[model samples]
Target: MSTPDNNWEDHWRETLADHKASPPSTMDWGGMEELLEAKVAPLSPIKAPISSLEGKTLKLPGLPWPVWAIAIALVLALGYWLGSHTALGVSQEMNTIPKKTSLADALTPPADTIFDTLFSVGANGELTEEIISIERAIVNRTTAQKSPEINTSLPAGKSPSPSTPVNLNREKLKAGSNDIAPSTTPAVLLSEAKAPTTSPEFFTGIRRPDTPSSAPGLSYDLSSKPTVRPNRGGYVRPLKTLSPPTDRELLEQRIKALSLSEKLVITPLRYKNGHFPAYRPRN
Candidate 1:
């Protein structure tokens, strides 16, 4: 009995046997031959005309050398003119501005007066005598003003008592005036003389004497040594003395062992004949 697959194979064989391969009638072989001839033909060589530029160098188009020289000169002249003009303007501005004077210069006496005072011997004595007289006048005026106030403040029936007399020594005043000179005024000297003087410690910093005293009988031995108590706890075990090898040391030892083993072993060479054998590579 013929199966469907066998029947299909037999029908395909008969159909293939009857099939014929014939050329197409519409094909133009003559046109195709002409196109092939055209493609195969060689092209003609192009010829360039020889000119003066063939041997000579081509220059860039720009201004002439003389024109360039003139332009550079003009630029330099303009720069010079600008620089001189700016410098002149700055000088004029500086000259037009006024010079400033300091407070010390304005307050200072004339050079002539300074020269006269420095050279003249009588000037010093006269200045000292004048200062002393001024101080005396000030002291007398202050005392007089205070006396009236004190009397007015007291009861009408009660007589105002005479106040202590102010002592003014010429030698002491002269010494003090000579020592301080122009730095201290007469009023300041009088004030300093009137104010009571005291030790620096009285007004500033901590007062150590004012602190309260310690209790009478309680005494402390600062020089005595401190007592130490005995340890009552159990004895502590000491730490292990042996330390394990680190990873780096282990790896180094492993590498050393591997190197020694590699030296002992004889490995076969890839190309014992000193030349690679030719073989087809697998795709």
Candidate 2:
């Protein structure tokens, strides 16, 4: 009933129709829609801003370990150099301080000068003169202190006899001075008077009180009160007790009684020592 073209079309359609169309299930359609939404929709900015920011990582080139180590070492070396230079300057300043000399070094005398002075001939003469002068002074003092009264009592016009200690000492000193040194001179005369000797003439002027001499096997009365000896030193009087005044005598004495207001007034309130009185108010 059809043409050849129509017949061929019908034949192909019939063949294709024999393989039935299989439509998708509800679960599969739902799954397909969820996947499409997840792929197409944009994420919320507030919920994942950190993740969005983290995605763009900076990739800068890091320095090498050796370079860092070299830089640190350079800094340390610079610091050490500066510190050491400062310390060196301080040490140099300390070294410039003047050192003090010791006490022993300052006090020590020059050996050569001392030795020269000691060996000099003039120095020896001076020392001998000094010693002889000292000896003469001593001898003169001894003769003056121990001189006999007879020697002192001689007439001023007459020269002392050669036997007197004063004349003998003076002659000896003159001889020594002449023998030793031309620079030496006689010493001054003594001022103190001569001591009196034990001669009978000295005792004739002085009279001593007679004292009783004790005999052997002689005993004195023990019951008798001893006599008070005369005191050569100053005397002191003994302390004495005095009787107290009786209450009847105190009552008999008159008192200048003050008024009640005067007694109550302070002492500073009273006029005294050219000061005007300042009276205190009564309570």
Candidate of highest lDDT:
1
| Count of clashing residue pairs in every prediction | 0, 0
What candidate 2 gets wrong by more than 4 Å, as runs, is: 1-62, 101-283
User: Among all windows of ten consecutive residues in candidate 2, which has the lowest summed lDDT?
Assistant: 208-217
TM-score leader: 1
TM-score of each: 0.18, 0.16
lDDT of each: 0.37, 0.35
Angstrom error of the Cα, residue 223, model 1: value is 73
What is the Å distance of residue 16 in model 2 from its true position?
99
Instruction: Report the lDDT tens digits of candidate 1 across residue range 150-241.
Output: 11333345422212122322232222223444225332233334332433323332211101111111111212211211231333332323
Per-residue C-alpha lDDT of model 2 across residues 101-167, encoded as one tens digit per residue: 8754444433222111011012112121111121121111111111111113344655332122332
Q: In model 1, what is the error at residue 144, expressed in angstroms?
A: 18
